[model samples]
Target chain A: MSLAATAATATAAAERGFLSPTGVEITFVLVGLVTLGAAMVTVTTRQLVHAALWLVMALGGLAVEYLLLTAEFIAWVQVLIYIGSVVVLLLFGLMLTKAPIGRSPDADSGNRPVALAVALAAAAALVWVVVDAFRTTWIGLDGPAQGSTEVSGRFLFRNWVLPFEALSVLLLAALVGAIALSRKNGGAAKNGGAAKVDRTAKVDSAADEDSGTPGASGKEQR
Target chain B: MHLAYPAVLAALLFCTGLYGVLARRNAILVLMSVELMLNAVNLNLVAFDVWIRDTLHAGQALTLFVIAIAAAEIGIGLAIVLMVYRNRGSSDVDRLRDTAERAEPDAPAAEKAEVIA
Candidate 1:
């Protein structure tokens, strides 16, 4: 390519926010910072439900980053699945458990020095590997053209049908497993007779309700 | 022969997420860390798909599948954890060390003390 043509290509890349241009560069930097901050909070938070919410922020930041890169479909999937479904399921679990809304002494570990050392070692190794692998290449902002839904749909049905079917079967098995696990067999065995079972069931059910309902204190904070 | 900006960012995100997975003990926090790692992988796949200019768009298509699987995994994992907590009253990682810890006759009187220690 000629010098002028190369310069024009660079300008176009910069305009698209993929390069270090003035207008779009700041946006990418800000988004990256926000994403990192949210991720840090997600890991560090003591409250399980609050951590899940922070995860929503982190995932949403990722989706925003995807949109900036012009991958609209992936961004929407991130929001729909991560924010809409996954985090909600997590909250449902937290609510069902007897974990107190206030701090749980069991939430943190005493052996943090070991965990931190392992984590730091893992992070350092990964950074080194990544830097070594992608040191010289400069990828441009222009992306592929075949990212529309139709193309993806066709590929899913035609080439990758078996793995897709397997995933469905896995989901069904998980549903059955969840039902079996939560069936209250222990309470039934403890009762041995019907009336005792009924009383025990009531007590268990009351506990469940007390935990599941967010309560007045929680509602006020929210 | 060059790494794209998205690919580099994805690598960083994934590595940090991996560290979180290794470090976090809370089951819910572990799930969130796993989600972060998945998102990082998704970013790399999408970036590479765009850079290569392939006709199939395989990377983007696979990312959609990854999102679906992640949702199911989190749902089922949390449900299991909740059930476990209902049975045992706690989700602490070290609680698994003793088989008789939750509701067993073999549990000692000082089991709680031992757990705390």
Candidate 2:
């Protein structure tokens, strides 16, 4: 009787629905909720850096969805790029800008009501379409072989070469443009007497001065 | 488990991201919101890819490229933001409206001051 009980227990463990398909479904719901909430706050947050941080949460949730689908490569890429680099760049921009660190009216003004309505309408339409298109469709396990790193690499280098090359060129152009823009802005601010850039720099510089050396300007905290 | 699970998650995420993009006034936050939207798109791609077995990773492969482009975009975007902060002072994207009206070469000196001040 004990042997039978033990066998039953083992079988139950193996069949634990939480570890099965049902588990994946529950996780999907929970992650979606969290991602949605974070994405909302990412835009609503008053602080620039705080918004960027919330974006990280939203991006991470997407990664989780990728993992649930067995797209391991895409999952990792999501983490490495969106969370790792994209957000960091956003923060860097926030830091460099002269926007009020505490509370700036300029950071919180827009036609929010209209925007919200439009966004909601668009989302509702998209959901309706997607749901209609695949209402009763079921996933077929035997459809395609799961992607391995090797196969992914081969496909990228082989069939998607044009797009890949185009992306690279786009990035290069953007890089050069960003550099030129930055330099030009720096010069323009000096020559044209812009207060926007200087205001942010002043606050940062003031903070720097208070901490250690006084009367120094534009020397950022290390 | 229903395939609708991941789809719902992606939709929710995308909606929230859209709200952020529309509501947030901070430039950095706007960029972050854009990232959020992109991630939501990625989620949809992966989920659909999973549901469609015949395609065999096409969706996921596209997602990888999206991630790569997102990374590069962030890099250059950050550099631009940093520069903007240096010249304009604050990162409030709303203040950028005036500059957008005036072409780059013809942007007024007072407009720059208004942003930094």
Docking class of 1: acceptable
Error of 1 at A174 (Å): 2.7
Model 1 misses residue B76 by how many Å? Answer: 2.2
DockQ leader:
2
TM-score of every candidate's chain A: 0.67, 0.71
What residue runs in model 2 are displaced by over 4 Å at the alpha carbon?
A1-21, A98-106, A140-145, A188-222, B54-56, B99-117
- Per residue, candidate 1 scores C-alpha lDDT tens digits across A1-222 of 345544554455444433334433456557867887888777777777777778888889888877766567778878888889888877777676545676555565655566667667766776677766654433455544345456566776777788778877877787777666555333422222332334333432434543433243245444
lDDT of each: 0.65, 0.65
What tens digits encode model 2's per-residue C-alpha lDDT throughout B1-116? 35556666667667777877777776677777777777778777766666553333578668877877777777777776665555445455665554244445475676456545
Q: Which docking band does candidate 2 fall into?
A: acceptable
Chain B TM-score, candidates in order:
0.79, 0.80
lDDT of 2: 0.65
DockQ of each: 0.38, 0.42
